[model samples]
Target chain A: MKNNTTLLRVITYVVLISTTSILINDIQEFNFEQFKSFASWSKSVNKNENWFTSKNAIMWSYYIIITALFFWRGYLIYGFTHFVSILKEIEKENYFSQKNINYFKKIGNVFITYTINVLVLQFLLSVIQGASFNFFKELKNEFTFLIPCGLAFYLLAEIFKRAKTLKEENDLTI
Target chain B: MPITVNLDVMLIKRKMKSKELAQKIGITTANLSILKSGKAKAIRFSTLEAICEALECQPSDILEYKP
Candidate 1:
């Protein structure tokens, strides 16, 4: 069990560092010049003009969507941190603790929500960039596995809950 | 949980301390407390037989339904 926890800990750190570096790299590559172009638009422009057709509006929306993607990645990192909490509980010999169960449920929520939100944001960004958005291709992306992983965690939480109940009953049988 | 545990009542009638009964039954005082507090979900027949043998009483003396 200790060996497994050590391996999990290493994996969690690797994932955390990798995602953080990716997000940082993305931010560095983001075009700040788009803001300059947005600002260069005349103040006297017609109010009736379609906002979606404007280059500045597309760039601005793309930036916001990309920022949202960054935030979702951070949320995914936060989910991974719960593994530490679970390991701590196991270290204390509390295998079926309520805290562990809650942490499992929370991780499930974070994984599914982060993946779904990132997918939507990416689709929105594609629209802003005038690129074709393919739902099936998006579904085939690596992060899509997070959905099933999230549900598996949710199932684990429920199993732990049942185990907790059984432990309580066994303890009181005397 | 709806089934009330009357182990405390049986202990009072038999003049036996909770710790002593827990010791005889080979269970912790804390687990006996859970049973006394009616927080236990279920009890094994073996444990019930042991309690009955130790206390010289029937299972009815230790467990009861109120509702």
Candidate 2:
């Protein structure tokens, strides 16, 4: 599973970098007047103007790549939770094997740290994009949604930490 | 790092099959097999006590110093 995750991370990075390069090229050659006309056409057809504005199809490619990145992040979180559960089961059997315990602890720490980093990055991006679009009302709404979601994620990490500690204590008791 | 379980001896002396003992102990047959094979990581104290009481034996009788 760890190997599989590493492979996925590598794939995600490759795709993101490639798509970002294409996006840069598109931005450099964009014709604002032509783009405005295209945007109006897109609006009339109820489609996303940004999706069709790029010459290299970077906009559509970026949409797909970013969605994949988010899904990968979700998969990582799921893997971490599964690992925590496995550790809990092992601990229940009073198996205090130090090496195994340390391995799990390290994984948990990494998961928590990465989760925080991702959330911060997401919040910053949301704020920057919203402000640029002058969408203050939408920004406020997003903040309301983000706060609870962030808290829930934090709470889950806390629960996993407490469970790990309790399992350690149980092992020591025996 | 080695420990010994005397579950088999207790069951044999009590004229009980592993399945019967497992049923009375309220654990699955698979877990009973784990205990019998000495492959179990650990056993709960409550479970140990129950096993001893049910088989009319002592903890020392069910678990031995394996060195």
Candidate number of the best lDDT: 1
The DockQ values of the predictions, listed in order, are: 0.60, 0.04
Weakest ten-residue segment in model 1 chain A by summed lDDT: A36-45
- Model 1, range B1-67, lDDT digits (tens) per residue? 4588899899999999999999998878898887788777777888888899999999988888888
Count clashing residue pairs in model 2. 0
Per-residue lDDT of candidate 2, residues A1-174 (tens digit):
456555655665665566455555655764456456545754675444444544425434434443443443543444344444444444455333443444455445545554544455454555434534334444464224534544555565566567766775554322
Could you say which candidate leads in TM-score?
1
Q: Which ranges of candidate 1 are over 4 A from the true structure?
A: A28-56
List fnat, each candidate: 0.70, 0.00
Q: Tens digit of lDDT per residue, candidate 1, span A71-92?
A: 6777887888888788888877
**TM (chain A) per model:** 0.79, 0.31
